[model samples]
Each structure stands twice: as C-alpha cells, then as structure tokens.
Target: MRSVPEWAQQRGFGIRVEWGRAGAVAIGAGAAGVVVIDVLSFTTSVSVATAAGTAVFPYRWRDGTARSFAAERGAALAVGRREVSVAQPWSLSPAAIRRAPFTERLVLPSPNGSAIAASVEGTPVVAACLRNYSAVADWLLQQGWGTPARPIAIVAAGEQWPGTETVRPALEDWLGAGALAAALLDRGIDTPSPEAYSAASTFTALPDTPGLLRTSASGRELISGGFPDDVDLAVDLDADNTVPVLENGAFTDHGR
Candidate 1:
C-alpha cells in the first residue's frame, strides 16, 4: 500500500486543513478529530437543524436509496432544493430546513460534506459552517482536541463539478474551514499547518463575508435558481452556537 508522507499528513500540527473527502481520509488517521465544512449548504443545513434540536444523519447518496436509509433509521430524508414542498419540507437548502417543521431526526444526504463526515473512521467529526465554526472550536477545546497529542483536521467539503466526480473547490467552504481554524488559533491552539494557516488568514482578512458569498459562484447559482434565502442563511456568520458532532452515525448538538 502507498504511504501518506509525514509532510503530506501534516505531521506535528495541532490543527490541519485539507480539501474534500479524500483529504479527510488522507489526514484523518493521525488526527484526533475532523471538522467538516460545507458552507454552500450541507454543514449550514446541519447547523440550522441541530440548532433546532434535531439529530442529523449524514448520507452519501441523494437517491432512492436515501429513502431506505432513512426508513431503516426512522429519519426524515432531506431532498434537493427544488424538491422541497409543503409535504416534503426537508431539503439541502438551509432556508428550507430552517422553515420546515422540526423533526426528531433527519437524514441529510450530500456527495461532498456528508460523504466526508460519514467516511471518517474511528474519529470524532464535527459539522462546521460559517454560522457555527466558533462553537465547533469551543466543543473541540472542551473535548481536549487541537493539541499536538490530539490533533484536529478541518476538511473543507468542496462542491463537485456537474455530471462528474471531479471536485470544484469552492471559496465558501475554504473560508468556513479557515474561520474554524482562526477560531482555534485565537483560543490558543496555535499549532497550525501551513495549509491551515492559509485558510485562517483567508478568513481573518475577509472584509465582507456575506457580500463575498452573495457574489460567489455557488451563491449566484442558488440565487439564480430562486433560493436566495439559502445564500442569505449560509452567510449568517457567528449567528449560531450549536456544534453538530457526529457520533454513532448521527450529528447531535454538542454546543457550549
């Protein structure tokens, strides 16, 4: 088997940052925990749902199988943005989840964020978004992570190109991961890999987060598709304090 080099693994860092599900796997084993950021909506939806006291199950496939997956767990499945209706109010849109009636549990399927969250083996995973990055750092610190002995990796779940498996790195997720990294550093978890540092710097220097999101490609796509509210809700920075921690196959509130 091929080995992940010490440098590639970002060895000796309290905090590390990498992109996509593959990045999670690359740095996951040596780390104490993983933070998954999907700002364009997966983690954002999770923040909104968990803030409402709902348990969220991350599912990798958004298909007919998702129904069976949710049924097996007795959870309501979140669907596509446009698929949301009065009867099926749960969808990937953070706005939709926020407006929907609260369910005890929800199955949120996404190829990016959910895939990374669920695929991390034997590691604590935290769902992070612009709204709850600081809260996630608080939860991690309380749990004694973000040390050299208990390193944490922040995985930015970038979007996939249409009709392809290729990843198209999104700026929002990068900034979201950076936001978390910056929060950790501000709290004295100063050992960050260069990659994590870059992300942290990017977030720290961001002058207009909401404005940037409004003009981002993902934001423009959502707005053009008539889900401007999703974009709005996504950029609600530091507005939430709920940290959704993935435990036993579901994300539960681990807030301070």
Candidate 2:
C-alpha cells in the first residue's frame, strides 16, 4: 500500500473522519487529538469502565502476551466473550464490564478499536461511543481542539473479517463517529472535512439511531452471539458523562 496522499489527510478541516487503521494514520497526522469509535463494543466498554472510575489499558494483540501485559500492571485481563467465567468476568462486552467486580485497572485487548487507540501517539487519544459522544465533543472543544489550528481526527475502528485482515467498516461505527462529529458541529465547531461532514450528516439524517444500531451487521452479530446487552448499552445515546482519554498508555477518565 502507498502512503496516503497529502490531499487525503483532510488538511485544513477542523474535524476529520476516516475509516480503519490506515485512515487513522492519515487523518491523525498533525491533528491535535484522535477520537476512536467502535460502537459495537470496545469504546462502549471503555466508557462503562471509565465511568466506573477504572483505568483501561488498551492492548493491540490478543495473544499470550496480553495476560503478561495485564500482570505487569496488576490489572485484570479481559477475556473473550465466551471465555468469561466466574474467575474472569471481564471481557470486551460493555455489559460484562458493568457486571464484573470493580477493579481499579483493566487491560482490554482488541484488534480493532483498542489497536487503534493503543497505537496512536503524540496527540491525545479519546475513546468515544454513543453513550458519551456529547461529553467527548465537549471535552475536545474545552481542550481547544476541533479548530483550524488544532484539528481533530475521528477514526472509526471498523470490524475485521473472521479470518482476514481486511476491514469490514461497520455501520454502527460509522454512525458512532458521526455522532461525535455532529456534536462538534452543534457545539459551534462547524468545519468538517467532506468525509466528516458525510458522517455527521448520516447521523443527523437518520430518524431512528437506536433501531439502526440494533439492526446493524455488527450489532446483529452481537445479538446472535448471545451478548445482546452489549448492543443495548452501545445504543444508550448520551447516557454517560465520563470521557476516557488515553494518557500514559491507559485510558483514564478526563472526569469533568
């Protein structure tokens, strides 16, 4: 793959939106901050844990090292959805985090959102979901981001195919990215790149966000996979106030 062209960076725009890891690298360049969206679960789970006053450590690989990564921090390692048991209840599922016994620190691993969040450096990284888009946008604006001088990059952590590295841009994440874009616009930060505008418009033009989320490909996957509560929590729009900001390799609430 070639490097993303200069024009494709959404340069000069106050708000930019892009898909997958490559998009994050492209738009993230020169931006003041990056907001990662994975509405199906990852970011939603971050919101749940952060709101509970827990710090989340985002890990890219789910291999054997994840356990050691958690162990080094004295944090609980999140298990697979079906792997959650009485001894290890924390998983990527938002509902699972909500029900799990409280822990001050947690290591959450994923190839999608967590990968994007953990990999981004230099600028601040924020975890945003439908549950706390408003708070995120508000926090960004408060920090003087989303301006011509300090642009904001919003990356939608699209899903990957079962056995491939190809990105499957999920509708839920697209809309989740748009939700924050729209909130930025509503808060008087009106300059969005064309891609960001399209995402924000898609969000505002929708009549039933909850319905759409419930029926999205990723959403349905969770429902059929016996984790409907996660989907339910992801659709809880503006339901939270905690904004998880990546600092020192962990997402700690920028508690407003």
RMSD (CA, Å), candidate 2 to true, equals 1.0
Q: Compared with the true structure, what per-residue lDDT tens digits does model 2 show for residues 1-256?
A: 3688999899999999998889999999999999999988899999999999999999998889999999999999999999999999999989999999999999999999999998887989999999999999899999999986799999999999989989999999999999999999999997889998999999999999999888888878989989889999999999999899998889999958
Q: What tens digits encode model 1's per-residue C-alpha lDDT throughout 137-245?
A: 8889998998878999999999999999889999999999999999999999989999999999999998998999899999999999999999998998899999898
Clashes of each: 0, 0
C-alpha RMSD between model 1 and the true structure: 1.2
- Clash pairs, candidate 1, are none
Counting only residues 3 or more apart in sequence or on different chains, how many pairs clash (N, Cα, C under 3 Å) in candidate 2? Answer: 0
Best-matching candidate per TM-score: 2
Question: Candidate 2, which segments miss by more than 4 Å at Cα?
Answer: none
